[model samples]
Target chain A: MFQIIKNEWRFLVRSRLLIAISIAFVSILLLSIFLGNYQTQKQEQTYQKATEHLRQQWVSIDAMNPHSAAHYGTYVFKPANLLSNLDEGVNSVTGNVLRVEGHVQNEIVHSEASQMQAVSRFGKLKSALLLQYIVPLLLIFLAFNTISSEKQSGRLKLLVLQGAKPLEIILSKTLSVWLYGVLLLIFVVVVYGILNFQNLTAEILTRTGLFFLSYALYYFIISGLTVFLSARWQNATLALTSMLGIWILWTIFLPNILMSSAEKWYPLPSRNEFQSAMTEDRSKGLDGHNPSDERGIALEEKVLKEYGVDSLSQLPINFDGMRMQADEEYGNSVWDKHYGSNRNILHQQKKSFQLGGIINPFIALQNTSMGFMASDNLHHQDFLLQVENYRRVFIKMLNDKQTFGGSKTGNWGWKIDNAFFKSVPDFEHRPTQISVVLSNYIMDVSLLILWSIVVIALIFFGTKKIKIV
Target chain B: MIQTIELTKKYGDFTALDKLNLSIKEGEIFGLLGANGAGKSTAINMLLGFLNPDSGKVQINDIDATKNAKDARKIIGYIPENVNLYPYLSGVENLDYFCRLAGLKYSKTELQDFLASCGLQSEANDQKVSAYSKGMRQKVGIAIAYAKKAKVYLLDEPASGLDPLASKELSILLKKLASEGATILMASHDIFRVREVCNRIGILKSGILVKELYAKDVSANELETLYLKFMQN
Candidate 1:
């Protein structure tokens, strides 16, 4: 089998067309990696400038009430993952910078205008795009005629007469084409590694390894199925056309149909509808600004009674801060209910989309590839969650400072020091561990494995019925 | 040795091969003569285990060709009319590749010797097969079977498109293989070539073996006349 595989490689290497396409393929990979790095750096520079300007504004502010300072809330900028050069996934359109303010949980849309320069969005040349779309097509072209051409030319019978089993012949050709694809993947990855050698981390390596594995599995399936069809078909044109048509269906048509179907099936609320619902819920709660409102008056009375004070003048701490913190907590609950439901809808969509992988492994490949690169929607949600958690901590700190920092009830004039303002911890995007990602993506990987197995079995069975003449 | 007992094949309602029995032993060449649709190819295909006979037995040496086609094929070499090979590979490379598939390993020099001994010029050994003539490709095909040391050789119109010299060379090569204790089965329409290369010849007509003749006992003119008579009837 190895001999047959090696011989096929020799045959492939000798093909002028294969050599030409291979050189072009490598060049395109190199260019893609370079462009991705360039885009990442460009985006990073813009983020740094925005971040610095925001920080300088915050630190330069004179002593002011912490509540007002909380209103001048900072931004959490999503840094580009080191492996994003391979596959930026949804990061380009998903909006990287999130606005974290005291009153507003997040104005996610505002960040797009305020921070992102839309660098990756203007027709991005992502390596993932090429690897996901073009490499498999290349494999299809390589393998679609592997057997049928022999059958067409009457060489298949000769090869068999020379002691090559039909199954072995088909498998060997498939492996050779698959290896060619793998070699292209490795070239891209190794070039990426060399370019980013200093930035390489264990997580990045793990992600790269997984990315390679996913593409490799996809290539195996493509090659095996194409070659099996090649042998199954007696006419070379029929085999080539059938494979090309299937490739179109798998990579192009099926993904769109599945995505649209998933969306239509588990529809998410419109942006305005979501905001209105959240707003109505927010209004139902006590208004921290209007302490005399029914819910607020009830709260004030309860607090006054607990302090054993009849009026605000006798209170030792700031009641306004307490009221605001109460409001913030209520808003937190509202945000959770709305955002969590939206997240659930998206999850349903993602699940349905992933399920399509059983029928078309391309979806599985796309999901797994983006997942390992840490640029998928799941990780994007994690980033948002971390940003929100930090915002909660940040606002609570300012509110507590006012409540217990020796400020009076009506002390609008009360101020906090810069040192206290600067005391809030920096927001860092915590990466989901590889283990967690793998566990969450069990279905995608399993489907890919299943596809590989099913294709091999089909080829094994297909060889028996394939026309020898 | 190759033996087919009551070998028969049909395509839909068209019986491709009728019940036929034949035996060709080692060191002998049997020629199957027929018109285009005379079931000659069908007989060859059935013997090669390419097509299953409706009712028959095919045995290559000791192995039942019907039950264990892979093992039987291990000792059989087939050179089709065209002998299509990898166009991108050289004559020698194509030979080497098929040989390797058969679990035979040959050094570059040994491989060149195989091609050379089959009358493929050494100068053309390294040139891509796409540049080779039909005659050259046929020589390489013969070299492939020769190098594998196939015990049973099935030649389907092996000399059909060859130039006169190439045709004579192929006959000589097959005779050499037969002399070296190989069984050769040549299916062809060329009565003269069959008379020259085969020790015995059989005529097939419309899925039936109508006549069998010993080449030693019949002249080429006589065989032609006999074949024409069989076709007419």
Candidate 2:
């Protein structure tokens, strides 16, 4: 068994093609790591400038009736994750910027995928993608002929006559292939760690470690299956073809079919329907320009009576401001009815997307990557919610000035001090933290862990009783 | 050194070897002669424990070849008919590799000297096997058997590709190995070569050993005639 392993190593050393491919794989890993870092830095700079612009706009707002300022809203954009470059996940397909204003909760817009032509369906050609798809296939290519080629050349019979146990021979061949795969991955990882020079936190370390371990198990699964097939087949060409076919099914065909089927099973509402439904519900509420409801008119009359004012001149507060507040509060309810339904639909879409986890590990990985990057549906939701929270505080501050700043009705000429403008809080968005993002994707994590376990089990138990002849 | 008791082999509905019994003592060169698909290779494979026998057992040096294959394999060296090896390696490296597999390690000089003794030129020892001729490759196989010091040598038409000179060299090598008390079992259709190297021979016909002849008691031409008669019947 040991000699078999040694011979395999020597064989690998002598194959120039294998050596060249390994080097190319390592180079690609380095290139991806560098590109990811460069892209992340560029995004961070853009975000910093956008944040400054929003702050400047807040500081320059003109003095006005407090209630009117509520209509001038703010915006918050999703921030990128530290490791977003390693695997962008669904970040490119999802929108980032969210608008928050009085009486309306806005949807996130300007998704990267929507703004570009589709080119990479396999997703950005990253190291992880190669590790998951290409590396295992390469291993199968190398090992599928391990035994069948020997048999075709008649060395298998020679080895058998020399008294090698079938199980030991199989294991030695498998171990050789497994070691090669692991070594190639480790070489890339060591290079990644050295280039990044970043502090390896427990989370980063664990996630990276899991990535390595999972891929190694995936390689083992391929090696065991290939060896079994090679031994059973009579021809070398047939063994190679059959092993490649299995690779295609597991890595490519099945994942794509599963993704599309899962999507069809849990379809999301079209964007047009989502927008129209929200608009229709909003129109049914208080129309600030033209109030058509008799009840709304009666409520205005009752408010005048309670205030003990006639002809709107004796009122202490600004009548226009009061009217605006009533309209704004009414509109808030309308926004709730419409926007709340939109959020529900999005949640449904997420549930449907997540259903793909059971059938396709690639889907699970993609979802997990998005969740970690803070660019998935949950991160978009958090951004909108934060913007809405800021809108409330900004509007309330303006309303307090109108109701209690001793301003009379119809005082359009009155002006507040610049200090008062500065006193109003500006919009500041807090991004979803790494922990929060990871928590939302616990199901994906579970699925990945499950796959790793199943593949490892297959290598041991599924192939333990394999017959060579 | 080797024995089989009513050994048989079957693949699906096709029976390759029927119930057969045979034995070869130490220091004897046994030849298994048969036409294609007549169970000569099948019998040898059973003795090597590479394939399982359906209805019998194989014992090598008193060890059951199937259940305790490793113990039996340690005492054996196999030379395949095609003389195939890792083509990227030098002749010395190939010999070193197989010898290590057989649990023996030799220094480079020791390996080169063994190759020299096996009819390989000193200059060819360090050159890649890919650049060597078929006859040169056979000499490396012989050198591997010499270096491994195997007690039992299994040769399946091992001299098929060698030239007349190389063939003569291999016959001498086999005679020397047998003289050193090594048990040799070879399967071949080369009746003349078998007569030159083997002491006793068994002729297999339609999955049965139909005749066993002592090479010393029969002329080379007579053994060929006997093999043809058995195969025809």
Best by lDDT: 1
Error (Å) of candidate 2 at residue B208 is 1.4
Which stretches of model 1 miss by more than 4 angstroms?
A110-123
Q: Candidate 1: which docking quality band?
A: medium
Query: How well does candidate 2 score on lDDT at residue B139?
Result: 81
RMSD of each: 2.2, 4.1
| Residue B80 displacement in candidate 1 (angstroms) | 1.3
Error of 1 at A233 (Å): 1.5
> On residues A304-350, what C-alpha lDDT tens digit does candidate 2 reach at each position?
79887665667666655555556566666666665676677666666
> What's the TM-score of each model vs. the native?
0.95, 0.85
Which lDDT tens digits does candidate 1 get at residues B172-220? 9888889999999999999999999999899989988888878999999
Minimal lDDT window, size 10, model 2 chain A: A287-296
Name every residue pair that clashes in candidate 2: none
TM-score of model number 1:
0.95
